[model samples]
Target: MENLQMLMYGFTVALSLENISAAIFGAVLGLIVGALPGIGSLAGVALLLPLTYKFNPTTAIIMLGSLYYANMFGGAFSAILINIPGDGPAVMTTLDGFPMAQKGRPGQALFTSNIASFIGGLIGMFIVIFTGPSLARLGLNFGPVEMAALLLLAMTSIGWLLGENPIKGIVTTAMGMLIATMGMDAVRGVPRYYFGSIYLMGGVPFVPLVIGMVGFSRVIGLMTDRKSAPPITERLHYRDCMLTAHDFKRLLMPSIRAGLIGTFIGILPGAGATTAAFVCYAFEKRFKSEEPLGTGAIEGIAACESGNNAAAAGAFAPLLALGIPGSGTGAVLLGGLMMWGLNPGPLLFTNHPDFAWGLLASLFLANLITLAISWVVIPILVQVLTVPIALMIPVIMTICVVGSYSVTNSMYGVLIMFIAGIIGYIMTELKYPTSTLVLAVVLSPIFETDLRRAFLISGGSPAIFFQKPISCVLMIAFFIFLALPIIKAMWKRMRSSKGGV
Candidate 1:
């Protein structure tokens, strides 16, 4: 009941004209960013981040949140129409969405995905509203030992899930930790990797590095691909571009199931929207649909779209309640919170009710805004995909350079960002997941801080991690997730050897 009252007050703040405008603007911008290929939410948010440093923290968060959710909403447009994923989460949308589009029902695919996205997002918000307080309550008991164990779990999952091989993931994670060790130590006020240079005092600038790695590197990679995606166009009447009453009836249950699935997976640290989408689609595949999946089935689109959108919402749970991010974009948002002088976690709800509740309330409104605009602008959104990638790359590249420069008032920042972009491109070429590196970078400081604190509290006893029940559970989970891959590999090798003998 108290949570309800707080949320009601949050709605008042969110409905204010200024915040509403921010939400609308973010939703529109996010949709545009999501529709652009290779410039996923991570880059989109990073590119726009420097602009928010000047805004009030609440307004800044509102805008960023709007962009994040709206990007998920807009991602389906290109996925359904052009068969290219607009964002990572949209990959599954292509399986069935594009098939539907190819069957001359482009509008139907768009409408189904838009509707599913809306429902999924709503489900995500409710899941947060219900679970956040409980989690926050539990998080209140998390001391250094507990938090350190949990951080380990998060880092392990990020590496294991983001790529095919865990070894590459661990290598990137280690590299990120090494990079993070650069700059002055927060506790000692002394440089670890500055090498007598004053400029390295601040360590690495996150926004600049992320902008280079995600936005700039993506642009550089596309510069070589050279080939354009399929052109998409449609003659539209209002009816053709909208979901029919019958279609809604067919989709309602599937979207709901996916919403739940997405919310569950999304709340787990290091799991992501892409994973949620795939999981839900696979889960739902056991049911009979009007059309077989991967064959233009609306049911498949519903499951994928809803799951991803819901997962986006679910990702916020760990981020808000534990100050732990589940995905690359979640890490970026976590970084934003720190920059704004706001700490995420259980205390945030008490210390910064306005930021927490206002952001939550704004998310609800952002969904409506995204859905309404998406339906009205389906034709316009579809046309965006047809813009030559050749033309878009240079323009996006210029923006990224400018965005990176704005992060630090130095040309040196630009140089570092460009170098990071090269590293990102190389990582891509070698099939080493860049996300693991970003995940490692994001978690390094937190993990170090908490582990040091735990050691201090435990009088230098490493067994402190196993002493607490919660920490023991987390540590066990961490080890299991970490060791399962190696175990499976060994089992496979043994079986192969036995067969050869």
Candidate 2:
């Protein structure tokens, strides 16, 4: 009841003319930026952050919050229409979304993504409202040891599930880890694999690498196969995009499950929407989908999209209650908070109830606003699938180059994009899963940093992982996942031997 009263007060603040206008503007701008590959929420929020400096803290945060929340909705636009992902979390969306588009149901795919994202974000917002401080406290328990163990399980389990050939998956996963290690050592601050280039000192930039691996590689494919037809040759109207009753049923359960799980994952330190999406998709793979994942299954799309959006919403718990950024974008928001002279911590809600609750209220408003905007815009966005390959190649190439160069304002990022594109194309030909490699690149650094910190805290003793309850549980799960294939293989061999005898 107290929470409800506070929320009503927050509504009063959020619904004011200035705040509502800011929310709408942020939601619209976020959609445009998120639909563009490589320019994700972090960059989008950071770029717009300075403009909010002169505004009141409440109004400033409401706009940025809306932008960040709406970005999750807009990311699926590109991932579903083209093969490219608009942001990191949308990487999982591309696995099923692109395939669904190819299967001549681009409209339905977009509908599923948007609806699932809405459901997920709604669930996350409710959870955050009721359990914000408690959830943040739970996240505090995930120290270095626990985080390392959890990441290990996620990497190994998801990597194994990604590819048909387990050996190839392991090899590619290792390859990504190697590439991630090229920059300065996380603990010692010494360059390990610079190979004589000063640019390697900073390591490979993630935005360029992702754009090259996922987006530019498609451009390369289009250039090589100029005669290939567009994915959607027929005209698609808004009416054609409506989901069937059965499709909604297929989407609902997964969205609900992922929303619940993703919210919790979001509250964990450094386990952002991308990781939540990957973990939720992997979890969904254990269930029976109407169609195989990566082949345009609705379940696959629902799980990852919902998971990412929910994680985006739940990320606010840690930021508001603990002053700890749950993701890179959250870090940017934290900076904005400090800059506005509003300290975010235990006293935030007590000291500035209006600012704290208004931001939360703005998220709910943004979720609805973004959903309405996406529904209106999707019909136009899906028309991109009908464009000729010849025209798309140059346009996509320009996006790749601009997105990459924009990250660092250097040609070095563009160079990395081209190199990664070549490698991604070759890997595609060789049938190696680029997704596995990209996931590894994203998670390995976190794993390495946490592992080193854990070890340092424990005087290099391996038992430190088992000493903590959370780390022990995660480590156990990791070993179980690692050994499951071997156990199954041995069981099969034993059964075959008995039959032969």
Tell me how candidate 1 scores on lDDT.
0.87
Q: Residues 257-339, candidate 1, lDDT per residue (tens digit)?
A: 99999999999998899999999999989999999999999899999999999999998888988988889898888888888
Q: Write down the worst ten-residue block by lDDT for model 1.
A: 229-238
Error of 2 at 340 (Å): 15
> Any runs in candidate 2 off by more than 4 Å, and if so which?
1-117, 128-133, 165-170, 222-363, 485-501
Task: Write one digit per residue (lDDT tens) for candidate 2, span 1-501.
Answer: 788788889999999999999999888878876775555666566556555655798998998998998888878877887777778899999999989988989889988999999999999999999888565455566778877887677666655554455446566768888998998998898998999899998888766776787667757866765665535445567886899999999999999999999998887655689889999999999999999999999999999999999999888886787565566577567756765788676567778889988889889999999889888877665554355667757876887887778765899989998998899888867877666666677667767998999999999999999998888988998788678756765788899999999
lDDT of each: 0.87, 0.80
Model 1 earns a TM-score of 0.97
Please provide TM-scores, in order, for all candidate models, with all chains considered together.
0.97, 0.63
